[model samples]
Target chain A: MRNVFGKIINTKMLYEYVSLQRLLFLLSLCLSCLYALAGFTIVATLNYIGEDIYGYLFLIFGICFLLTGISSIKINKKKSVRILIFSLILFLIVFVSTAYPSSVGLQDYGLSASLTYNMIFSIGLIIFGLIGALLSLGALFNFKPLGNQYGAYFLLVVCMLIILYPLVIIIGQVTINGAPGITWEFLTSDVRGLGESGGILPAIVGTLLLMFIMFVIAVPLGIGAAIYLEEYAGGHFMVRVIKMAVSILRGVPSIVFGLFALAFFVPIFGISFLTGGLVLSFYALPMIIRSSAEALKSIPQGLREGSLALGATKWQTIRRVVLPPSLPGIITGVVLGIGEAAGETAPLLFVSTLIIKMPPNLLGMVASLPTHLYTLFGMRGGLGDEVEVAARMQNAWSTALILLTIILILNVVALVIREKFRKEF
Target chain B: MKKKLSKEHIIQGIFLLIASFSIFIIFFIFFFLFKEAIPAFIEVGGDIFSTDFSNELGLGGAIRGSLIVTGGALLIAYPLGIGGGIFLSEVASVWIRRILKPIIEVLAGIPSVVYGFIGAIILVPFLTDSFRMISGFSLLAGGLIIGVMTLPIIISISDDSLKSVPREIKEASLALGATPWQTIKKVTFPAASSGIFAGATLGVGKALGETMAVLMVVSAITRAPDSWFDIFESGPVLTSLIAGHWGEAYGLKVNVLFAAGVFLFIIVSVMSIISEIMQYRIEKKFKGG
Candidate 1:
């Protein structure tokens, strides 16, 4: 029994257990997998080409199923296993029958029936694939050990794939569409007619300017706070309260930060670059403080003690012994904070000038990459002409690509610093 | 020597002031949100909690929408995240971990606006087509986008928690003739349950605070879903309400949006605090306290 179901099942045994019921189960599984593949192709393309590919795939699956079915009919398998596969196939087929066509208008060739039919069919196929694979694994092998182990592995792999799927799509989409819009002129010129004809020079410049101001403001205060909390505070009550507040602060929505900036900083700084920068700094502070504190905490206690033992004052110890070793960690935090601030749009929505034709000054409003994308997204339908709309979309994609590239670079740098440069205590 | 001692005192004072700046910022955020939000609470009275979007800026629908979308997001994220965590912490080898960890970080770093852009362009139309919804901007789309956005947190935190389970416990389970799968299911999972729960709470907090993606994908209509399970319907969440209405809102409307902001702040803060406490407890537990 274990030999049949185990990882090393011989072809002789594999064919030996192929009862009529087992053949039916194998055929159903193969058909459902094909349905799923067809569904995936159809949904992905939503084109006639997808249908053509589906036909070819179906033919291939059909031949494979036929071959397997012909070669594998020898002995009866467990009735219970046969019953489970039969019911599972029945359930899937039942779902396929009831899967109604989507009511959404399919003006092109009345493709609604095929579209929705394949979609739900593929969904049923996926469910059946999961159940059938498990049942087949158990029926073929000892159910107790290998089936459960591999089944759990299968589910985890699916979860990882699902998580990675969007990332792959987003990057691929942005690069394919946005790459065309990244010409030299597009990089240098100002946006014209809702990002149709012009470039994003001002937005790029403003993003950098905002990052600079944020770096100037957030780093010292964040590092200082981190230093105080990690090296100096000891067991103070205020330290604990401050830490709690920081955690809570980290979770505060960016939109609320926008609201706060609108109410507090805008009145004081008046929608200028400084206000946007300060709001971003406020958005970034918790992260920096937390990360910097983590860095400071990781430095060996002996190093600090060694400095203090040598009669180096507390401040002197931190400035020399403690700071140098943890610099990589602190710098990584700053890079991440900058990356975060660069992509922020909500906090800047109410505060940023958003559509500045020229590069921003420190005292004036800013045009950032994120807000640029937001503005372009918002204006897609409002623009009068199709050309204008399409152009705006092109620019939006380009902006997203640029923004993603910048953030990804920063992330990689941080990753490098942590992996290569960080001092291991 | 005396001058050096006084210099140290001065530096300490300076650092103290800098550290307290965080506390001050937190205070001002609360103060400013209150200052702006209180007017709506007073004028709208108990109607501030009304679920009807059309009823003079009631927040009931938005709150309910927030719950539905966030709940939906949690539904998708929780299982996948824990499973991914298990894969990372237990199943993957050290070399694989080294590669996968950074990739997950990159996933987390992808800006919310980018997620929104993709969702608005791809997922929304797909959902609209598949489900035959009004426009495709529904609780489901918002939930899906936010679910992806929140996956990294849940994955990393759960991975951390699962890894934190003392190896001895798992080893003992193995010694008792339990299979590896059984060890994970029975021993490691039970021990890491609190930490996993904390990761979930943190993920929920993040999903709750998500703005741009939810705003872009969730059709921000000011009405509760017709039924509790009606995720296909478009409804406003608090973050979306504040963001979507900010452009045209005036007078009492502005205060109402601020009130929505206050509501978001309080709820997310509560989630963060709870998760933090639970994590602290887990740390204490593992430390033999």
Candidate 2:
């Protein structure tokens, strides 16, 4: 294999083996890069031209660049290193040309129809060109077989970045906006004046209380159902029905749960802590069941069999052998369910009420964190002067931050428990 | 021993009851939603599909808006999600995958309300400013936010599917002189396509059923878009319609909202069932093969 590879590289005739198709491929790549360059710089330089034509030109350029860059994959195969280098240079030109309008210089142009069009066009050009450049560079360095692999990895990296961008921005914005509002006073006093003044102590306490109630109501049922499915039940009709019902329940929108509560729980229990907790428990049940079932599944069957073989009954084996190892996973599930319930607003919309002055009793209306944030946002413009409205907005942000913090803490705890107690058979 | 055996039977019976509670809850939810919604279905009849929101309560526009927003969301989610999945399963180092998996989990754990709040505060004004629209609340904003919300589902499930492809098959392809990308494209992706499709279907269900954020970012105007591509205009979706109007809803309006909930429930249930069947089939295929 090495001798054949060496012979092919040593051949003089192979270096001159460029066909018309290859030449056209090279020409098209060059022209496409030029088109993107002209679209980015020349189009921006001629800003007074009708913006419509610029958009059309960009649309044309974007397509041209994408098509040419994509087409080069097939055309460049087994090509000489010289051609690969040329293609790399062309891609570099396209990248540098397009990077200007889409990057740091983006703000200078301000927001305009043509500017937005130009920005979108340039960004597309940058992405395609950069991918092309990476592929060609890989080929240029004698990684011919792995060139496309490198390009694929580049795309995956881009996808990861796209997924992470919003999370970073959401957390950054919430913390920056909500940090000042989270003084000691904010955590320990009653929210007054339609949330224009005072703090969210009642809301915080109510959220904890609601989480507790939800935990108490949901955990046993979820774990019991999971145990029944995992240990007790056989492949029967009831099991299938239960599984299907759980999936259906999981897909039911939170607002639908709210409507269900309004129609059923509210009429029976009225709008109180009981109603809210019941709805949230229903909301949390599917998640808890699913996760707990997963946890139970992870316990090796041999352990259960070993216990049963030693004369332990099924329940005894589960209580002593199965439950201990799976406890962390079950706890993780319960914590996640409670975390989800804590951040839920839709299920509590009609089932809970805002109580600013005091902590809510079990059978009375209560404030939950998510609903408090919602109420504050709803009252954004109706309350008073700008300052008061701003104050309300601040409280809304703080409430959001607190809600986010609790959920994040719960999630971290869940992750830690899962990792810490993960058992390998 | 007899007493202990009977106690075991009693405990099993208790568990059976607990397991069956889900079915009971599902039945009750359906019964009550139908009880409230049937009145509107009978009274308004076919007019429940009306697009106009001025005088009568109708769901046609909301349904259309829901479809449009979900379509937009799917466009954004399908590529990024599957790509991220491919990366996690096929490309990333172990430590990178470990770090990224939790980040995606945290992304999933972020509340819908926070996503909506961020959309309303940041994305709305940005869209309004860039597009020079009358208001920033549009279906596009709703789609963008919901797309992010559904990514964790699609990514994680697709990753699982891709990872489940047998290592021996991938090695055989690599041994055959196929590039890694070729192996992924021709072997791995085809094998995992059904699972990815399942993920996409579940993502559709999620995007369709998303509320709060859509309610916050999308216009409350209970009218259909002026045209097929008119996402710049504010339009209400079904979830948003039920949530936005339930505040002052009275008499028939309340029932109409319930009717909307019924449709949302039905559509999302169908999506879930289809995805569930697909997932079950995939699992069977893998285990059997």
Candidate 3:
């Protein structure tokens, strides 16, 4: 009797574990079915039914599938998985056979001209159905109870894919569309006829010049401020206030900075590169200070004390000892700031202009890569000519590709520098 | 010795002044925005809040639009970003974190204009087809693009906060026969709540102030939404209004734009202050002060 009781308890435990796994399996199955139904409806309506009949047919089909799956799971029968898989396969076969061009039934449905459209629809349905079927099959085949360990891995992979997929698509699309337009001549000549012809030479030069001016102005001030905050200020209330101010600056919208520059700098400087650069400097300052301060804070206190003990002055220690070690970090911050300033459009919009011809000097209006792209994008209906709009779009994509490439390179280089110097401490 | 001391004092003084420059600029921004914005406020008086669409300088519609877009963006960004953050700090292996960290940083580094461009070219058409909206440029499009743009900020900051949670508490929870998820839910998340709040506030501030992406995708319709909850309709946000009008704005119109900027500045500043205080409190609590 005791042996029989032990066997019953063991069976009960096994039953509970199986039930839990079934629940999780059903959840993923439901999600996959919903996803498939949505995809199917989108493809069908967008391609054939003209978006008016969306969600009706698919909703009905999805509800039916959900009901069938739920009832099957509730029955605690081993053949439910086989039944689900069989139905999915049967549906796939029917979908393809009906959607195919050579099928004799096509004439009856009046979908002969939409052979390609039906094929696309079938593809979406097949993809989602296969995923759901496979996940369910895995759950069915496994007798041992699945644990949270596997669930954790599943969640991680899904989330990572969710984050990475969009990046991949954007980069892929930009490259495929833009690479043909990135010829040497396209990079060298000045834009003419409102970005319909010629190259982005002036925009490239102007972007470089603006970055140079911004660096010259922002780097010293940012570094000095970082130094004071890290070394001289201690934990004073004034220091706290300064930190708050920097956070506030960081939080201020880039557009407001543009407006402030328009209100303050443009009238004084008359909408020149100087005004643009000064505003960009304000934008870069908080990043520079925060990054440089973090770098300085990471330097060992023992090293500072060691230098002081050896009779080196505080300035000497900072310049010779602290600064050298923190140089990579500071440079990383500067590169990041440069990348940010280079990509900025709003701050430069009012303070700069879209000059097809290059500016004669810093005080004159200039073209920039971002502003040039903005101009090209905004050239849609205004150009009136379809060919001109197409050309402008091609140029805009190429410019975007170049801008993204430059920023990516800067980031990679910063990462490399940080890794190289990080091991030293 | 005297010469050395004098030189050091001078250097300190110069550095101090340089450090104070940011603070000076903050006040200067306030002064400039208000100097121009106040005149418009006084001129428009009660008309500033007018719901009339014909009133080009009305703040009511723009304010409501900003709230709707920002709120929608927060709704999308907070859960995904915080979940990603939790995964990064707790679940991801060191090698995976190394690969993923740079990706997140690079995503963050991508300019707002590029996001806008992508949104205009890709997201707008997709939304139009899928949702069957007459026009694709709507609050939903703006919110989505901003949400994507705000993800990196939320993830990076929240990850930092979650990483700051002491390991001992997590270990203790695990030792008490709790699962990893349970430990994270019960101990790590609560301990890191303030930091997460700070990150969320920063994300809200970002979405609130995002101009170019919204300006590029969202139609600049300066009117009240058809319904309070209708995110599918095109509307004018404050930042977009400032950006859209900045090109042709003159005299009173320009001041009104500045008034919009001033409003943005105030809202953003309050959020920033709150985030800063939250961060401070977190630090203090972690330090056992």
Which candidate should be chosen as best, given lDDT against the real structure?
Answer: 1
Off by over 4 Å in 3: A1-153
* Tens-place lDDT digits, model 3, residues A153-265: 45545555556655775678789888999999899887888898898888888888878887898899999999999988898897999999999999999899999998899
Superposed model 2: Cα runs more than 4 Å off: A1-115, A125-144, A423-425
- Model 1, stretches more than 4 Å misplaced? A1-115, A139-143, A422-425
Q: Taking the true A–B contacts (Cα pairs closer than 8 Å), what share appears in each candidate?
A: 0.66, 0.61, 0.55
Question: What is the DockQ (computed on Cα atoms) for candidate 3?
Answer: 0.46
Give one digit per residue, the lDDT tens place, for model 2 in A1-425.
46545754687565343233344445444554454444434322323233344444444444443444444454354443444454455455545554444323222333212225444444454554454445344443334556567656766786787788788888999999999999999999987878889999999999998888888899999999999999998677788789888888888899999899999988888788889888999999999999999899999999999999999998999899999898998999899888987788888877655677876677888688888888887777675999999999999999899988998899899888878885433
For model 3, state the Cα shift of residue A131 in Å: 13
> A1-425 in candidate 1: lDDT tens per residue?
45544533556544545554466555655564445444545555443232223334434444433343343333323535353444544544554454443333443442221235445545544564555445444443344665577667766776787677778889999999899989998888887765777898889988898899889999999999999899889879879788888888888889999999999998888888899999999899999999999899988899999999999999989999999989999999999987887798989888665464775677787689998998898888866688888888999999999999999999999998998763464
TM-score of chain B of each: 0.96, 0.96, 0.97
Instruction: Highest TM-score: give the candidate number.
Output: 1
**Candidate number of the best DockQ:** 2
DockQ metric for all predictions:
0.55, 0.56, 0.46
lDDT of 1 by residue, B2-95 (tens): 9999998999999989998888888899899999989999999899888876656899889888998899998989988889999999888899
TM-score (C-alpha, index-matched) for candidate 1: 0.89
Root-mean-square deviation of Cα positions for candidate 1 versus the true structure, in angstroms: 4.5
Regarding TM-score, does 2 or 3 come out ahead? 2
Model 3: how far is B236 from its true place, Å?
0.7
Q: Rank candidates by TM-score, best first.
A: 1, 2, 3
